[model samples]
Target: MLQIYNTLSRSKQLFKPIVPGKVKMYVCGMTVYDFCHIGHARVMIVFDMVVRWLRASGYEVIYVRNITDIDDKIINRAIENGEPISALTKRFIDAMHADSDELGLMHPDQEPRATDYIAKMQGMIGKLIENELAYQADDGDVNFAVRLFPNYGSLSGKSLDELNAGERVVISGGKRDPLDFALWKSAKPEEPVDTRWKSPWGEGRPGWHIECSAMSCELLGEHFDIHGGGADLQFPHHENEIAQSEGALYGKDRKLEDAPFVNYWMHNGHIRVNEEKMSKSLGNFFLIRDVLKSFDPEVLRFFMLKAHYRSPINYSDAQLEEARAGLVRLYTALAQVTLSQAVKAELTDLQNPWVMRFTQAMNDDFNTPEAIAVLFDLASEVNRTQGDEKLVLASTLQSLGGVLNFLQRDPTSFLQSGTKDEEGLCPAMIDEQIAARVAAKNAKDFAQADSIRKALLAQGIVLEDKPGGITEWRRA
Candidate 1:
């Protein structure tokens, strides 16, 4: 009983998979021309959260996030770097995986590269041509006839007239209509030879829109449960995907086009930095690896989840520091319990009131911000109690966090591993300082003990002196 905000429907609806207990989802993944930015990171984390929740709800999920390994950007970057397209794409794909690993992302069940599905794309394009939904342009490129598809702008909620008026589509010389998009692009003489595939429409490559249509249909059938991507893709990319997929493949007679292409469409919002869109032209673009340099990977993940997936998240040092502090507070509560108990414990009692509330929040459109509030409340309870109740509360906190792939680290290690500061105190140094402070307090040198506490505080570390002279320290 989960309600999801479907972009196509423009409202929250109950999620019902095509198959009873199975979910087949396709998310448009990274276009590997360069390192993934914070925008790309949001797409990665948002869908990851979705997949985690779906599986936790007892559904078998086959998540497929496609990689655009062969795109115009990839080709241009390869040419600029004076390397083969394969070499350029390989480096970026590896970098993307490293970032994914650091962010604790689950690998998609199938990551189909666009290059491998050229035959499928060609087949779909040929079918469209046969149905008269597509035509080969005078320039040897095949373009989808948008006018023939009556529901072309349904996903984006814009009519052909509205799209034509608002959109500034550059009219290609051979295109019959400005709004028509290419299904197959004829190769250019200057482009890489390997980038071109021999198709019925001469030596060219699949257009950006057709790639997803072909790959998703080939892997997940003509229709699937969910299709997700960034909001920017809603207009031409996803709208065109719906057009081509349904225009050629779906429906009984193909002309009526009555079948749905994708059941639910989910789009994660954009990432803005300091109230502006994150872009290279604006000088606020941050690569995922670069942000991971300053903040812990968990901190970055938490930052993205702090806001609802559909809401635009503001990225700044202050926001990240706040996220870091909030995550530290959650981990600090877990640190109160023994590491073995915290890690090994499971939520056997789903009927617990807190669990019920958490499930309610998560079921309502993956309301992570609300679900996370339950964690904070649980942590507060864990900190105030002891013995059996505290054990249960702490275990519940860890179990709930694990549903979102959070709170899996050893609490002590997680608390101590602060941000990457070259001049800041390391764990050994902090421990040495704490030992000195403890020794001074034991020897009745109150002034020296006070001095050590003040010094550590000035270095962005907080110390809590517990009974029996145990001092716990964490980055402030």
Candidate 2:
């Protein structure tokens, strides 16, 4: 069984899908105006782990994450780049996919684009207007009438009064209330490009909130199991989604059963860097690609899991180094165990406890940090033991490995990849150096041989002298 923190209920609930054995989870996706930052990394990998665990435990998850390629930012970016909106959005989506794959995320079952669902959005707008939940203003903008929806601010825990208090946009002449948000915005007469569509009211582009409401309704259903996004979006974007979805999904009678919309809401906390909020305006943001260039992708994934998903992760070079050392420790233990030709290694009934314990920790709440500690403990035991069956030991390590999403390949591969630069070479390069050291020792210059060994060690390489003066080395 799995447990998830449902922000709607403000409690951790036993995650029994509304339809047993199936989960319909919708995670809000990228805006596509820029590269995904480490903040986006937290959300991408955290849910990847969540989806992986649910699938591993025998549940069918239809995960739907949308790509928001149509909006102010995208339009502004296209204009700034002197390219079409299609070109700009496509370039970023490619970058986003590269970053996502590098982090080892499982692809969502459905990835809907906002631009594809304009018709569905128009339909929903028609329903809202008919129900008196929304109306067109004198300026040709259709706005959701916040005063008409009693549950308008429930999801964000903010009241209509609070929203009105901090309102920044121009309160259009005909808008009934200050809290009303735009469902569609008319293209200004003075604007250079007209990106609007022909709605019943006028030609206008769909608002940010309308796209999610319509896309989710069309892709999943009138109701889904979970709606997830960043904590920052909890207030206006999500609250607006609830209002718009609920308004159209039901009839005049307003029975809750008619429009079940979403049962659970989940929000992952923000990511900070070096105890400060990372922002592009602050010039403190790091792109996912830039970070990946220097660090192993799995190291980044492991770093994300170090803190709970609901807590803010502080991104820093120190944290990266710490994650690297932790990875080294894990792969080192895995390298020592040897697997046999048998698919299932020999395990006595008495020694089958550790992997079980690790699974228990993971199932509790996808508690990766705890599961990782369990892994290190198991690795330490395997490293300390003598006369143990190598096959059984390797199998034991493999068992815990899947849960961490680590140690899947040969441990030597991991160690080799990570230490190549530090070693100033790879296996082939080390072999060349070994021949030089051998020639020196052959000349009876033991001092030169010692010098070569010290040089390799300085590069984090360890050499072992073997039978007949042959030598092989691996990273220590």
Candidate 3:
């Protein structure tokens, strides 16, 4: 049995899928106006880990992560670049996928783009309007009446008074109430022609918050098992999703039901840099490719899983270097043993203490930090054992790592390659230095050999002189 921390309930609860052996989950995905930052990567990796663990736990999971292709940000970026909206969105979408692939993320079972779900959004909006939970404003935009939805602030755990206290006095933007949010926005003259669509509320596009509700309902049905996103979205975005989705009536039932729209809500904490949240305004924003220039993609992945998904993770060079060293130790252990391919099949055996511990850690709210400690333990066991027993333990280590999408590479290759340092020698240059050191040693020029070894070591390369005159090298 597995338990997960449901943000809606504010506590960890036993996971009971709507369908006993099946799970249908929807996660709010990237808004493709720009390159994905570390924050975006965390959401992708966190939910992907959830999906992986659920499937590993013998549940059939239908994972849907929707793309917001028609947001104001996307339109503005396209206009700034003097490109078509489709072209701008496609470019970023490809970049996003490239980033996801580099970070070793699994493709969602269905990635529904918001632009494709316009009609579904309109349909939902229509239902909200009919239920009097929504109305077309004087400006031709349709807005959800937040005050009318009695449970509007429940998802965010804020009372209307508390939410009202934070409201600023500004032009209401044609909203009847300051707290009301747009379900459909009427297009302006300056906006691109393609950005608008013919709808009952005149010509406009769907709002940001409504996109998830429409896509999730249309693809995963009226109600699903899980809905997730970043912690930043918990307030206005996810809270509005709950209002629109739960506030509407569906099927033969013409009244709002008591049943919740989503059974469980999950949110991953933010990524912080230098004791502050990573944001562009602070000038500390990092793009995924930019960070990958210095560290291996797997190292970044390992760094993320080193912290509990619900906890904020700080990003710095020191943290990443520590992650690389930890990953190298695991790979180093694997390199020392010859493993049998069939040994991985024994992962389900509860008799294995390591497997039992790893399973327990993962089952308790996907506590990856604790689960990763089990990997370190297994690696130590592999190092302490010998012959066939060592091989079995090493193989089991690889198998368990696979459940979390780690340690699938050849250990030798992973150890020798992957890390990047601009000031350090390239692979060919390092090999040349090693060959020179080897030649010097063979000629009995001990002083020159020591000098060469020292030079390479200074440049972040470690050399291991092995049996049969073989030299092994890896980045330090």
For model 1, the run of ten residues with the poorest summed lDDT: 250-259
> What global local distance difference test value does model 2 have?
0.78
Residue-wise lDDT of candidate 3 within 315-337, one digit each (tens)?
A: 99899999999999999888887
Compute the lDDT of residue 272 as modeled in candidate 2. 85
Clashes of 2: 0
- Stretches > 4 Å off in candidate 2: 163-175, 190-194, 251-259, 340-352, 386-390, 419-423, 435-450, 462-476
lDDT of 1 at 255: 51
Cα-based lDDT at residue 126, candidate 2: 91
Candidate 1 lDDT over residue span 365-417, tens digit each: 99999999999999999999999788878888898998988998988788778
Worst 10 residues of 2 by lDDT: 341-350
Q: Write the per-residue lDDT of candidate 2 for residues 238-315, one digit (tens) a residue.
A: 888988899886633466546457887888878787688777768898898888888888888888887777888888
lDDT of each: 0.88, 0.78, 0.87
Model 1 local distance difference test score = 0.88
* Deviation (Å) of 350 in candidate 2: 13
On the 0 to 100 scale, the lDDT of residue 272 in model 1 is 92
Residue 33 lDDT (model 3):
92
